[model samples]
Target: MSKVILITGTSTGFGKLMAITLANAGHNVIAGMRGVTAKNAEAAKELGALPNIEVAELDITSDNSVNEAISKTLTKYGKIDVLVNNAAVSGFGLLEAYSLDQIRNMFEVNFYGVLRTYNAVLPSMRANKNGLIINITSGASGHTLPFMIPYLASKFGVESITEGLQDELSQFGIENVSIQPGVYPTEMNNGSKSGIHADKPAIIDEYGDTATQQFNALGSALFSKMAEFKMDPQTIADGVLALVNMPKGERPLRYPLDAVAQGTDQEFIDARATIKAKWLAKYSN
Candidate 1:
């Protein structure tokens, strides 16, 4: 069955790989990104040329863009079978050094952006009583690391939301899962390299170069390892495909497609299942 799928953040990284792979697998895909006519025009053109793919303009932060994109998707495809919330931005270095606005903006995209898409698509999903939501989170969701506090916190927030949805939507047969990927050499690493929100002059004098210098050392080592063993984006694309093809109610809530052994997301998934079973029993009527 060729289902209609809408994916955000298709301009690069996991989103782009998943969009292309799913469409190639005979699914109807709507690839949504921020700059359809501008920065990502080439990507849009390429994906748009695919037989089952349509490129759409969607800035997940703006409710208007979110609504319009969903509306257009629904009008064309009747209903969306899956919504992949993959649009996310990351920042590194000291959490204290970055301004509040910088952290908030990252949160807007990583956390609230998913919320917008969830709000836009869940109505249709619940009405249909069958749909899927795959949030592309990170290994940072389950584990913490230095210098990446804000980015990891945002992922943690997304992780929490996805977990709640898993329990909340189970009765409706709408699956909500998070893909906690390990380090991959996607454009996201490029963003990480640029170190968005890495420095804050407000507190730099107080802390001096102590924290940032340590972060720089960590980055160098991590980048070297990434060059040696970075996971392919296809690892996640395949995971998404499997989750889509999985029978309803049989899919796990978290799929950690990680090459590195950072957080052991699979072990965490098992632990969560045990916890959910025991914990939710208390609330059962």
Candidate 2:
């Protein structure tokens, strides 16, 4: 069935692809992004021309923007059957090297952005007793990485939200899923898009050549593996579409779309689920 779907960060990367893909599949798409009239004017115009897509300016970090965008969507569409929280900012730096404000800024978009969308959308979703929220998390969200600590931490927070909300909203038939995408050569990772990287030059200088070398080596290896695995951003878009079309109660809580992980991501997800089930059983008893 055709449903109304609102996706954030639709100016580029996975969100854009998902918007296009879902709209092509006959769903009404509200393509949400910042700078709709400024930096992303072309993207907004291009997507807006599509019959199924309505371009909306939405900066997820702002409660007013999120609320307004969702309000308009609900008012027009009558209901949003699915929300794809694909909007997020990525950061890379040593934990100590990042200033509190920088870290907070990253979280404002990556973590709190998800919260804002949920708060805006959940009331209508609950009233309808049917909705699905798919969050685009990271491959390292299940664990952690060195330079990308802050970024992964934010994604991890979303993972936690997806899990907790799965049960919390179960009674209302609202389903939640986090899509853990591996290294895809999107604008975010390919240097076309800017990220909230480490700002403390003095602290970075203190870490010196050794730290630089390690960060460089890690980047090289990740890029190499990404190329080797042929990680396509479209895979994530297709995954979101599949989840949307899935039977209401049959969707998995965590969907990992990392070919580079070579099933290790699935293994980690399975192991974590098993451990969580046992832990919950103990608490219940």
Candidate 3:
């Protein structure tokens, strides 16, 4: 079946790959990005040259952008059968070290961005009484990665939101799904290392050179580990296609993309269970 799909963050990463692949697969793709400058226009032209791909400007942080993109998509496609919330930003640093503005900006993009997009499409979906909402989260949603506290927090919020939406929207015949992809060779992981500033200012008068060296070492290790497990963006796109194609009853609410992510998620769940059990035993009524 050739369904109409709307996707965000199509300027790059999984969004771009999925838009191209889905269009190639004979679906109508409304690819949304922040701005349609000359560069983006060229990219959209290239994509539109394909079977059924179109690009629209959509900044998830802005209500006008989100509304315009939704209106344009509806005007072109009639109705959206699938909505993928893939627009998000990465933030790094110790939790205690980040400023309120920095934290708010992170949530604005990662958390509230998805909410805005979801709200923009819900009215139509509800009226139709059928639709799919796919949220692209991260493996970090289940496991904590050092120095990526803010990013993890945002994704955790996404996980919670998706879970609740799945149950709440089911009554309306809408399906909500979340995909947690492990480290992938995207601009996201490439930009992660440089994007987050250190939480604390350097105390050169006290712990000078050693402290700086340790911080540098930690970042290098993080990047190296990410490279070791990085999967291709196409792998994620394939997983998304599979999840979307599954029958309603058979579809999983959350899909972990790769083996490594599955194992890491299990470990995190087990650790949480153990801690909760211990706490209950220690303070039981």
Q: Can you give the TM-score per candidate against the true fold? A: 0.92, 0.99, 0.84
Ranking by lDDT: 2, 1, 3
Q: Where does model 2 exceed 4 Å of error?
A: none
TM-score-better candidate, 1 vs 3: 1
RMSD of each: 2.2, 0.7, 4.0
Instruction: State the lDDT of candidate 2 residue by residue for 53-138, as single tens digits.
Output: 99999999899999999999998989999999999888788888999999999999999999999999999999999999999999
Query: Candidate 1: deviation at residue 249, Å?
Result: 1.5
TM-score of 2: 0.99
- Per-residue alpha-carbon lDDT of candidate 1 for residues 1-285, written as tens digits (9 for 90 to 100): 899999999988888999989998999999999888998899899889988999999999999999999999998888999999998887776777788888888899999999999999988888889999999998768778988888998998998999998879887789889998877888878663233575677776677778668878988877776677756779888999999999888887788887675556677878878997898898994
Report how far off residue 49 is in candidate 1 (Å).
1.2
Please, what is the whole-model Cα lDDT of each candidate in the order they appear? 0.86, 0.95, 0.79
Which residue runs of candidate 1 sit more than 4 Å off their true CA positions? 192-195, 275-285
Residues 1-285 of candidate 3: C-alpha lDDT, one tens digit per residue: 989999898888899899988888888888888657765676676666777888888889998899889988887777889999998877655566677787888889889999998898999989999899899998768656666778888898998899789878987889888888777767776773235444454433255666557657877865676567655689878877887788876776677775545476756655765896799899996
